[model samples]
Target: MKKLILPILLTICVIAISCQQKEKQNSIPKMVNSDGSYETVPLEKDTLVLKLIQNSVRNVKKIENAKEVVNENLQKVKNLVVEACTTGDKPNIVLMHEFPLTGYLYGGRKDKVQMALQIPGEETSELCALAKQYDTYIIFGSYAIDPEWPDHILSLTTVIGRDGEILKKIWKPRNIKRFYSSFEITTTTVESVREKFIEKYGIEEELPVLRTEYGNIALSTVQLDPFIFSAFTMKGAEIILRTSTLFFESDIIYTAMANNVYSAMANIPADSPYGGNSMVVAPSGKVMARLDKTTEGVLEAKIPIAKFRENRKLPQYAIELTKDIFKQYQEEIPANHLDMPKEKLPQNGKEMKVLLDSLSTWLNQ
Candidate 1:
């Protein structure tokens, strides 16, 4: 009887231990899959464990839905930008030969030009007509008030395309200058900068003509980007050529070669709606040539056609610009952990890691 009782006690002890082990196993952390990765369990599974799983699955579906929504919005914005550029059809070739074309760049404010440059009205008209004849796009700085829109006097950037079509018959009503206003130096503003430097250095004037122009002539200046601005004057009814903001504005007068010269003397203000430095891509969407913005605020560079074909996803222009900037200033970028702004500390780490992972995958591909 004693042996039998001892065996029963041992059996009871073993059963109790086995029950405890089962409980421990049930409470152990579990792993769950989340968006191509795994996450450890936050709590023990119980009767409510199934509910938590359902909620998690729902949250994941919401995340996927949110991603789709974001992608749709980005595509919409890209499409609108592209559509705005194709509003006008190309000009006819024969119509371009009929009008005489005169083109010049300008300093935006009246203070830029100390000496007067006179362009006759007939010549201006002839140039406008010739630009239409040659299917050439011309930019004429003029002072004009639209007959239909009275009381709206403005120094205008007039754009005329070669098909005898005035692409922007008159764009005073459209504010298009802020997009390209990137250039810091202009011929008109240079003298003022020089004067300030001279005063600070206690240096005597090198030349008498360096004196600054102090006048109030309702002169208008338009900022186009980092490098370009247009200045034109309207006195009573006449528009005249004034000083230009670009140091090389007058360079085209001597150097008009196809490779060196800009495609048209007349382009939209540096910040116009069509302000992108152009990137020409092949039919296969390879970048061929990039019309990069020059230091002068002009779109001047034409990259090799082969370079365009190399990038298929990132816009050729943006990639080239990024590559060039990184090549010159890679050290300026902070390392992965230190790169983000202080305000971004909480969110950036995870996003950055994800982005790095994606980039790594893309590079491998």
Candidate 2:
């Protein structure tokens, strides 16, 4: 799940409670916009947890050659995520890991080339175990090597139901190397992965025209950008919801006549070079969830457009929350003082703490 970026204007005609009552709103969502889009509603408990996990692991590793650092960081995150998943021993689990390796073209150098270059065997196994233990399904993103083709490739592994059972996978084209990959994951016993793939990737056969509340969304065969997951456009609602194995890409965007969500997050290295995760985006973008391999590994939260719409102040409000969290991380562990070289380290644990705390507060906010 990518972070909420930009302010989504909701025109719900409802008064909102002050931030003090945000706790009560946890079960019930506040109205941020006054366009009558949605009534003040409360998110289910599971929905909130999913949002928290999304933001927890923003930037996994930042080191250049710190393979060991990357490996350790990934494990720590996995443990934390696993713990969260089994908190109440929830029966059915849907885990999505959106690793955006080739999304950002910074200075002509892809940010996630490290993870894209090679598939870390250990990391793959770890994720597989998590899926098995929780009976979870994952939308894993990374660079993959073509077993039959003659090239290195970036791919999203559609691994599901544990024990190295591959359900379905999609690959993307980036220069000579294939960059993006996505697909649906089902049980190994699933007789027809292709059928599920058609259902997810090819939703058109089922619904020729889909209607949404906003206006109109257009569902096309076109996979979303970066990684072409599955794209559905509700032309009636003017919203496009895309599902990518990679998080940063706009798998889901509510596009009205005015603004759209660049709802993209960064990719976590299978072997993170730093001690934790780090996610980078334009100041306007937001991170929605963080999924790791551990039991307590996942965290999720969302900036409901309704919460801050009373005075057209929700976007800035979310920005303040993100900035304050970053500031807190700097206070806890000065980035300059980390053990690893400056370039190789992701934001320190202290920064992650700030992100986590901020998410917790946002839920209450």
Candidate 3:
């Protein structure tokens, strides 16, 4: 009777321990949303880790050497990807600065045409191979020669998926023209610009968002306009990647906080006057990781998608500003100011300044 009783007690202890362990494993943290609804905290699968490489831009004068430069930069990027992967968990996405492979062209049409490579051409093929090798989505910028217009070049941001497929290509809308003596400035009218985008991409919108497994990502170039950021957030963008030749600025941080989305900027290593300081900002506007201004390095961060969504639900200044004003002026404000008619715009820089001054005076009144 004593032996049977001891065995029964041991069995009960074993069953109790098993139940406790199962409960612990199944339990998850919970948080209350602003709407008074409860939700389980997101697990590892709900987060996206990203690595943004701030590579040095090597300017190659000869078009023939472009492949070599691309190969060299790719090697550096691959090494960084490997390094990031080896450290604990691997990154879901890898991003490179503008012109990471093919350096940005500052010369005339001849130079641009010489430097521009075809989309899905040799460079992107190699990049796609790397993306498949790492099993990570990669985003990189380059100057691409428009197949339809051999004489023209477009600044392109190419996104390669984990399966080695080219997912999307975004052309830079706001192109900066430098009045250099050596290069001829093509006077592009507002109507021509609108026609060019509609003819090429079939979309009138300047900022286009790409829906992905990780989050809704939007790509942009050097120009960091608050309105553009707001537009993306309004359209349900969760992550904003700005590939630029310019340095990371405070605007990126502010945009992240205002929109309650993860914002990242990848820039060259001070090779040009505008390039330097790559950075990543959290949904709360905190700097997660940053590469030094002069160094060629990678910035990695884990973005909590669930938490970011929750942050978006919180009251934000940008959202407040749009409460009544946005709907009222939605039709009045042009999507792209450059798309506006020339007759409504100031004729010259002087006239533009005068008009701005007059508006400022009226606003002050």
Largest lDDT belongs to which candidate?
Answer: 3
What lDDT does candidate 1 reach at residue 270?
36
Q: List clashing residue pairs in candidate 3.
A: none
Model 3 alpha-carbon drift over 4 Å, by segment: 1-44, 176-192, 271-275, 311-365
Tens digit of per-residue lDDT, candidate 1, span 185-292: 212121222333334432221111111011111111332221111111111101111112222222222211211111122122233333222322222323333333
Instruction: Assess every candidate by TM-score.
Output: 0.22, 0.35, 0.69
lDDT of 2 by residue, 1-365 (tens): 22433222222212243443665546432322444242222322212112123322333344363355445545654665476567754423233334322221111112343333344465666666776776544434544444332222234434344343444453331111112232112101111122443334552332222232212222211232322221122111222222232332333322211233223222333333321232211114343443442222343333333222233211212435576675665322121121223243323234423433443433444
- What's the distance in Å from true for residue 247, model 2? 7.7
Q: Which is better, 2 or 3, measured by TM-score?
A: 3
Supply candidate 1's per-residue lDDT for 83: 31
Report the Cα lDDT for residue 1, model 3.
88
All candidates: CA RMSD (Å): 30.1, 20.8, 20.5
Off by over 4 Å in 1: 1-125, 170-221, 224-365
Worst 10 residues of 3 by lDDT: 183-192
lDDT of 2: 0.33
User: Can you give the lDDT of residue 148 in candidate 1?
Assistant: 31
Candidate numbers sorted by lDDT from highest down: 3, 2, 1
Count backbone clashes in candidate 3.
0
Worst 10 residues of 2 by lDDT: 183-192
